[model samples]
Target chain A: MAQLTYREAIARGIAQEMRRDESVVFLGEDIAAAGGVFKGTVGLLEEFGPVRVRDTPISEQAILGAAMGAAMTGLRPIAEIMFADFFAVCWDIVVNEIAKSRYMTNGQMTFPLVIRSGNGGGLRFGAQHSQSVENWAMMVPGLKVVVPSTPLDVIGLMAASIRDNDPVIFLEEKALYATKGEVPDGDVVDTLGSAKVLRQGSNATLIALGNMVPRAQLAAEELASAGIDCTVVDVRSLVPLDTQTILREVSATGRMFTVEENPRLCGWGGELASIVADEIFYDLDGPIVRITTPHIPLPAADALEDLAIPSVTRIVETVQKSMNS
Target chain B: MSLDVVAPLLLDDKLDLYRSQFALRQFEKRAYDLFLENYVKGTSHLSIGQEAIAAGVARAMRPDDWTFATYRGHAHTLARGVPMAPVFAELMGRANGLMAGKGGSMHLTSVEHGVMGSYAIIGAHLPIACGAAWSAQYRGTDQVAVCFFGDGSTNIGAFHEALNFAAIWKLPVIFFCENNLWMEYTRTTEVTAVANPAADRASAYGLESIIVDGNDADEVYAVTAACVARARAGEGPSMIEAKTYRHGGHSRADPGKYRPDEEVAEWLAKDPIPRYHQRLLAEGASEAQLVEIERAVNEAVDVATEEAKAGAVPGEDLLMKDVWANGGAEWRN
Candidate 1:
């Protein structure tokens, strides 16, 4: 067994696929000789060489359009947008081109590509650089959205996305890069639409994704000491949502809550809440609560930003008070 | 290739060029007539007078090569050797359409014919063409990607990005611009910074500046052949500007009222089909030979129209069929 940081897992995950398949290529800004700005792809250039691991220009449209063309023509390409917020610069390619090509062409063209970007608030990167844009991708019909909460989940989900035939948006939690977790001895490949129940309880179910998963787990642990037993479920993928696991967990406890980092309006939580209410409305104790950031631009100031995002104390208190009512 | 001269072209080659332009001309006229009859539900863009570029370019390329077209793509689709029925059915929203009516007139795709797609958005296909060439380069293949766009595409950001990317990476791509004078209602020169959109920008990307008379089939063929050969030989990319004009308005809805009648008569006099027909007669090509080819092309259009008219509008089954590779649009268990 070995301990691997989330950043290390990203390179390993990409390297794992590049080793297995010659057609799997990687391209992005500052990713080749520079070892990536985030340093997640440090050794890929050395291993795969310059041909397979390419460094692109500041042209986001070129990077994505190239990936799309390559994917359509018998190659699996992974393009990086550098930051999730930059998706706005190339949303047409991602949504209009990549997402709808398969459907529009009547399955005549298939896109086996992965678009990876650093997501979420922390480290005070400001509003322009930091955004959890998984919801932006999830709202599209053809894209598969995946956000990894753990280091091992990174490798597993990355491998799954590269193998899947559709375009997958892999969002890496920016703050979780330095955090380390155990890496088992052999290869690890996970499913895209599966949710994991980290901690089980009978009182209620707390479903969270990406950066909010760890915070929700910590909140669940702290609340356990206060006699409020809550189940923490990590939603790994959003598009092919694991409604079975989510609804089952929420149904067993007859309560549900979503801890989201995206803005309140049109976040992944809002969609899940609607689904939960539609499917299992009678199997609830109280109204489903969504612990999320307010609908505003995230602050760059460290203290204010920390207060804006839902913290463990806030999650625990919100769940405790809601359960009591 | 001399200007408006076919001395270097063989008699059979001249006949083939005539057939290509004639087929496209007859097909477009029929499409416009169908729109008048209320058969075509949405809009269609007809490249009536721009047949020389399509004819010469498609004739010059290898059948295995890929083509990326724009929304004004009915000419490009037929140029790739796709039967007229599927394309017409696609425009008419029929079940037997090119994409099973999933993609209407603007997004016709025929992978079997190497017509990758007909992108509706302007300038989007330039980089995608670069990507296709990138794959061909990666796979160690000699296939070159030929991207066709209007003059308006030159001003888009993707156009600049793709040109720079193609130049830096030396990808095998040929960017062909059909300067049909009018980019939708306005003249291209009124809004453009440079007079020659595609050719003038070639210096910025370290490529040669080339422009040709698009009305001359022999001229476009010679230039396109050289560019394709250069791409296949791994000589990076070539940007070509073909100066042509659209005989009709931009799309089916437009009557082209903004154009002065004198300007319209000047272009209509230089219609590529009749000009090529006259050229074929002078090049030792018999009038009977061309008359038979035109007859065959007209018959082909007539047969395609009958078949497309016989098709049904796609049902709900096709509506949800192609959302994923698994042939289902289901997002959940």
Candidate 2:
């Protein structure tokens, strides 16, 4: 195993895939010389050359449309939309063309493209740059959504997403880029729809997604100190959700609390809560609780932004309330 | 401009282009008839007066060259040698359709025939064609890509982005803008800033641009042939603006009251089919041969319509299939 940061693991995963498959190419704005604004694709242009690692103009629609066309031909293009919030500009191509092409063409074509974007709110980038929109992607039918929390999961899931025979929206938390962890040495591939149980406990099940996993872990640690033991489950893939793992955990611990950084209304957390309520209503000891961002645009102020996003304290408080009820 | 400027055509090639143009006209007329009789469902945008461009462009392209068309693509696909049966079946939503009824009139694709797809959204497929050309260039193949869109598409951001990208990369692509003078109901002049959109924008992207009479099959063929040669020789992308007109409404519902009577009549007089036929007759081809071609086309379209009607409607099971190539195993239990 090698210790690597979240960003390093992502870049290494892409490099490994590019070395494995000649058809794999990376395209985005400033991804080559600048190595991406967040350094998620550093050293790729030097290693793979300009043909493979392209620095495209600031055209998100063309970036995705070209990626779709390239995928239709014979290239596995990993397109990076600078931020998740910018998806609005290219949503028509993503939703109408890329996601619907396979099904619309009756399986005659396969889109092995990955759209990587920086998601979650923590850098005080305000409403435009600091919004998590994984739920918008999860609502699409043919897309696979992945949000990795740790460096190990990021490497494994990024490799799997690139190799998979479908379009995947790989959401990387901007706040977790410098966070370090021990990633396996080589060729680590994770199953798309499987969730990982970071810490097992019996009092209540705390399910988190993307950056919420670390916050949930912290919340679990605090709950453990107070003798309110909780199991922390990282829901890696949102579309092909690990429903079986969630149900199993909920069955073991009669309480459930879901956490996310997106808005509370109609977000992914609501979908999880609905699934748990519908499938395991009889097994639940109390009502399902979701600790998520309020249904308001993220403000630039640090205090307001902190209040708007979900934190460890909020998760712990939600878990305490669910446990007591 | 007089029709005398058109170069003389070989007897066989002239007859072939005439047959293809006639077949497209017959197909669109029959499709509209079927739609009015309630046999065909949904809306269809017919390329009635614009058949010459499709026939000419298809004739100029090699079988290996890729072609992307807009939503008004029946003529484009048919001219590329996709038979009338599957085309009719697709419009009717039958199981034997090109896309097996999933893609209706707006989205038709046949990879084997090099017809990449017919996009419903305007200006969306421009970059897609550039990507295909990029793929060909990256793989070291001499194959080129041709994208067909309306004059209105040139005003969109995708057109600029795709052209600029192709220019910088020197990708082998031809941007064929069938400037039919209107976008839906509005005149192109009212909405667009430039009088000649393709010619005005080509220099901005460092691409060579040409203006051709889209109603003249021979002219369109000649210009597209030159552009194809330039692309194959690695001279980068070119924009060919084929000025034509649509004889019918934007869709089936409109009566075309938006267009002035004089304007419509002026373009109608330039109807490519009869003009080419007159030229053929003047070249000493017998009228009997033209009649025979028309009869053959009519018979073929009749058989295709019958076969399309006889084809099955997709079953309920088809709704759940093909969402993913791996059968969406992760989503299912």
Candidate 3:
């Protein structure tokens, strides 16, 4: 297991899939000759000709709609939207068309396509570029939502997404791209809907996703020093959430704190909190706590942006408060 | 204008082709009557005056080659050899329908017959056809895809994108637009600046375009045969603009009051069915023979209607059935 950055791991996974299947092709705004804005498709055009690594026009609607069409007709197309925020423009193709076609057609078709994009708030990209929108994707029935926090998870989950028969929204946090970890090489495929207990404890449970996973683990370690003994759960797939594992852990701890970078109003953290409260409310010794960004658009200033997102410090404070309460 | 090229499949017998056109016309007319009598569950966009376009293009396509169309698609589906009984049953929303009553009039599909699907969404199936063409070429099949849309579809972005992609990839597809001069209430003249939609746009994509008399089933069949042959021979995509008219409303409710009375009268006078029947008669078909064919089609349609009415409706419990290929959870991870 060699150390690889989350960005590298995603790139490597795409490369492996492209190499294995001739039908696998890549399409996005700058994925081809430019090797993607994030370089996730670096050297892909050279390895596979221009036909396989396709650069498309700026229309996200066209890019996604075409990919859906291609996938329906038997080609496994991996399309990238530059940012999750841009998914708004193509929501018709995503929600009405792609997500419903299989069910509407009575399973006469299968959309084995992967729509990969960067999400989450950080890097001072402002409101348009910086926003976590996995919650919107989770509401859709026929789509699979995958959020990988580490390099290993990115490599494993993306490989799984490409091989998946259904349409998968493989969301990569732009903030976690450069973060490195040991990614297992050669067929790093893992099952979807499985959450990993990064650090196990009994006093409290801290569930997080995407970039927030690392911060949650760090917070748990810090809480351990303060004698809190927190459990950290990485929610890899949001739609098919590992609710059983979460319920068991929450039952044991009787305290929970969920963290997410998206604004608090309709963040993914709220979903987890609601589920915990609804399912195991009687088991809780303390109120279910959540650490989320302020309910507002991400500001351009670094300091304001920092305040807009949940940090390790915020998670620690939220956990401490929940324990004390 | 004819390219004056060598024809891949010669038709020394235009009389046989005219017979197919007559059959299509008769089929649509009887189906419309059944629909009017309320035996058919879904509204059909009958191809009464557009028989030649469907029969001509579909006759040239092989079983392996794919075809797709819009909601106005009885001719396209029937011409592609989707048996008249199942087609009737499908329009009637019967359980034994081609899509098992899941897809009503606007959405007919039969994988076995190579009729990819029919979309109610205008211009949407063009890209889908390109994708199917890509699949065919990838699988090393000489099969091509024929995508049928309307004159109004040319204004949609999907139509342009599909053509550009098909041209760039050199996918074996034929973009056939039935320029019937009307998009429900709007005329083609009000929408596009170009006189000929298909041929005008073909030069933009480096594709060869042919404009044919869509009312002449023989002309449509002859032109489509040459185009499909060229595509199967590895010469990229082509476009065929079949100039025709929908002699009925776009759908069931519309009165089609927008079209000029004189124009409608002119098109109705030269209806494809009678024109083809006259041609067949001129080519030595006896009056009794023509009448016999008409009787056979009417009887077949009647049986189809009776069978469809007798068939059971899909169970309520089966509402969530076939949501996905496997019995996995309806929600994806």
Candidate 4:
């Protein structure tokens, strides 16, 4: 087993795919000669020529459009949008074309393309550069959205997304890019619509996604010391949500709490809560509690920004509140 | 010996290009009649007068090549050999339509025919066409993509994005802009500062481009053929601007009120179908033979309408079926 950081794992996965299939190419703002904005595509241009590893102009719409064009014609293109905040510029292409093409054409077309970008927050990238737009993509019908929390998950999910026939949105948390974890060798093909239970418990289930997964695990560990058995679940994919797994865990524990960094109103947590209420309402022993950022613009101050996202303390408190109810 | 490029189809290649335009003209007339009788629902932008541009450009591409077009896509799809029945059924909102009636007149699609789909969202199809070209070139296929947009689409931000992408990636695509003078009610010159919309923009992207007399099927065929050949050979993308005129209204309901009386008459005289018909006659297509072709066209249109009338309208249950790659919310559970 090799200790690989999330960035290195993604780079290795891309390099492996590019080597195996010549049609696998990449285009982004500084992905080629400059490696990558986050160094996830580092050393790719050196391994593959400039013909395959391209540096595109500062146009998110064009990068996505070109990637889709490449995907439709027989190429497996991996496009980078620099930052998740820039995804707003390319929403029409993402939501309408790439997402809907396969179903619109009666399953005749396969858009095997991966759109990867960093969603910055705790690094203090500010309002323009530090927003998670995955919820917006999850709201769309056709896209398969993924948020990997660890190095191994990044490698495995990136590999699965490259081969999947549907369009995939791979969001890599900017702060977690360098976080190291053991990524085992050999075949790495992770399923898209499955939630991983990080910690098993009997008291309550704490469901989280992307960067919040590690915090939920930490909360569960802290709760374990206090004799509160907390089950932690990581929702790897968002659009075709693994509701069955969520329901199964909730049914066993009889209590549920969702933790997310996104704002409260119309957020991914809201959708998950509604889904649980609609399906597993009778099994719940208490009101499903949600630990999320308040419904306000993300603050710019260092302390305020740190307080805006969900902390392990906040998750533990929310779980305690659910249990007391 | 140097490997010679198969030259673009000339006006002299009457059989290849003429048959296509002829099919388009007949399809439009038939579709118009159906539209009048409430057979095809939704707005139908009939490509009655501007048939040559679509037919000529599509005739230039290979079978495996891809195309994305505007709402006025009958000409493009018909020229690409998508079965006439499915197209008409699609317009009629039948279950047997190209998109299984999910898409109406403005959104006809046939991936098997390499026609990605027709978009009603103005310049929205340009980026999709660019994507298709990228996919084709990535797979190392000789196939190229052709995007057909109206003069109105030139003003959209998507047009700029698509052109820039194609130019930078060196993707195999031919951006065929049919400048039919008017954008619904406004003229092209009124909205655009560029002298020639597609050609002028092509130079900005460092790509080869040319403007042709769109009514002249020969010129349209020649220019499109060259661009298509260049694209297929991996020389990169090119822009072809066909300066033609729309004889009918923008959509099914609107009358041609904005146009001057004399302008309408002038364009009618230079109708693409008749001009090409005269060329066919001069090139030894006998009057008796020409009459036979016309008769066949009229008959084909009649058969299409009959089939469309009998086709089943889509059920309400299917409303949410194709919205997801998997069976959607139902299958997710």
Name the best candidate (by TM-score): 1
Q: Which DockQ-derived CAPRI band holds candidate 1? A: high
lDDT of 2 by residue, B1-333 (tens): 123423446888989999999999999999999898887799899999999999999988889889999999999999999999999999999998888898888888888888999998889899889888988887888899999999889888888888888888888999999999988889998988889888777888876657899999989888888778878888888899999999999988887899999999999999999998999899878999999999999999999999999999999877888888685434723
DockQ metric for all predictions? 0.84, 0.65, 0.43, 0.48
For residues B163-237, write the lDDT of model 4, one tens digit per residue. 888887788888889988899988888879887877888888897668888888777766777777788888888
Q: What is the C-alpha lDDT profile of model 2 across A1-325, one tens digit per residue? A: 8889999988898998898999998899999999999999999999999988899888888788888888888889899999999999888788988888887777778889999999988999999999999999999988999999999888889989999889999999998999999976768877888999999999899899988899999999999998899999999999788898999998899888888889878888788888888889999988888898999999988999988898888888877766766
Tens-digit per-residue lDDT, A1-325, candidate 1: 8999999999999999999999999999999999989999999999999999999999999999999999999999999889999999888888889899999989999999999999999879989987889889988999899999999999999999999998999999998999999989677899999999999999989999988999999999999999999999999999788989999999999888899998888988888889889989999888899999988899999998998888999999999999998
Clashing pairs in 1: none
Q: Write down the lDDT that model 4 would get.
A: 0.82
Question: For model 2, which pairs clash?
Answer: none
**Candidate 1 lDDT, B1-333, residue by residue in tens:** 222322356779878888888898899999989988988878889989999998888887888899999998888889889999998998899989999888988998898888999898889889899999999999999999999999999999999999999999999999999998788888888999999988998999999999999999888888888888888889889899999889888988899999999988998898888888888788678888988998999999999999999999899888788677677787775
lDDT of 3 by residue, A160-276 (tens): 889888899999999998899987657788888898888889898888898899888888889999999988888899866788888888898888888887777777778778878
Q: Which is better, 1 or 2, measured by lDDT?
A: 1
Query: Could you give candidate 3's per-residue lDDT for residues B177-204 as a string of tens digits?
Result: 9999998888887778798877798889
**Which candidate order results from sorting by TM-score in descending order?**
1, 2, 4, 3
TM per candidate, chain B: 0.96, 0.96, 0.92, 0.93
- Local distance difference test scores for all models: 0.91, 0.89, 0.81, 0.82
The i-RMS of candidate 2 is 1.4
Comparing only chain A of model 3 with the true chain A, what is the TM-score? Answer: 0.97
Q: Which portions of model 3 show Cα errors greater than 4 Å? A: A59-62, A263-278, A286-297, B1-44
